[model samples]
Target: MAWFMGAVLLLALLTALLAPRLLRLQQERQERRADEHYRKQLQAATDHAITTAVRARLAEPVVDLHITIPMRVTVGDVIARALEDFALEVPWDHAAAMLRHRLEFRGHARWPDLITDVFDDEEDHTP
Candidate 1:
């Protein structure tokens, strides 16, 4: 009886010790999967997507003002808009900052000028 009890206690102690590591492994796997998904999304993203994504993220959700926020524009739709706009390629975080800066200091009035200034293509006019 004593030996059996000792064996049972040892098993329980071992399981308790091992549980945290197992949980950590599970969490790591989830993070890896999430990262992979984000990578796939970034790959399929277009240049102007970064701009609209930033805009949507910055949008205010006002409740009492009779404002109902809508779902973010689809990635495919943003890519199509980018195709129409001829925007420059930018990394996600940088694009967000640039868009914010443009909206703040430059405003929508000079948007086209700002794009031309920031992403100048001298080659286009060289010929």
Candidate 2:
């Protein structure tokens, strides 16, 4: 019985020593999967023009405007650039609402300020 308990104790010690490394490997695997999924989504969204992006102050979207996404650019950055370019003609509220519908944004979005500047502090408050 004492030997059995000793073996269990040894196993527990080994597990404690190796657990952090195992956890790190698992986390790295998850991150890789997430990155691959994000890349696929970006690839699929490419070659597609943002049709409804009205300028921040303009009544209509830019005429004959199209952006062919570069291979290296992230999707969020592309959207940010589009918003920045259109900031002068499009209304703030419209741009903000449009952003949510146009792409699947995750984590820290690149340029929230473009729309935030349009609304007052209370109006732009997001949880």
Candidate 3:
């Protein structure tokens, strides 16, 4: 009986000592997960905005001399280049703005001009 009581007391003491630390670790892990989720959501929104802009550009009739005449570049090449620029050079806010502008105006903006405008508008807006 004495040994059993001693063992129970030891187990309880160990649990009491470790419970708070375990709870703290769990809270930290949850916070990290939430932060990661937020970042992924932001990135998805940015990607969607940029892709929408590219789609709008492609859907428009090329009769308007807004797009640069590609001598050897295919449509796929242009789209790939636009995607790369959005990913590397254009900011998220600018991509979102471009998408909004394209949707609103339905105008074919030149690729170079679009990129220049994105860089020129330095407002910190959220998508």
> Cα deviation in Å at residue 124, candidate 2?
30
Over 46-87, each residue of candidate 1 has an lDDT whose tens digit, in order, gives: 334545654664585665556444324333443355345544
Off by over 4 Å in 1: 46-91, 94-127
Once fitted onto the true fold, the runs of candidate 3 whose alpha carbons sit more than 4 angstroms away are 64-66, 69-127
- Candidate with best lDDT: 3
Candidate 2: where are CA atoms >4 Å away? 47-127
What would the per-residue lDDT of candidate 3 be over residues 1-127, giving only the tens digit for each residue? 9999999999999999999999999999999997676545444444455555566666766785765432221222323444554443434554445444543454434443354233334454433
Writing each residue's lDDT as its tens digit, candidate 2 over 14-97 gives 999999999999999999997676444433332132322222224444555573222222334334544454332333344444
Pairs in clash, predicted candidate 1: none
List per-candidate RMSD values in Å. 15.5, 12.7, 10.9
For TM-score, the strongest prediction is 3
* Residue pairs with backbone atoms closer than 3 Å in model 2 (clashes): 55-89, 55-90, 56-89, 56-90, 56-91, 57-88, 57-89, 57-90, 58-89
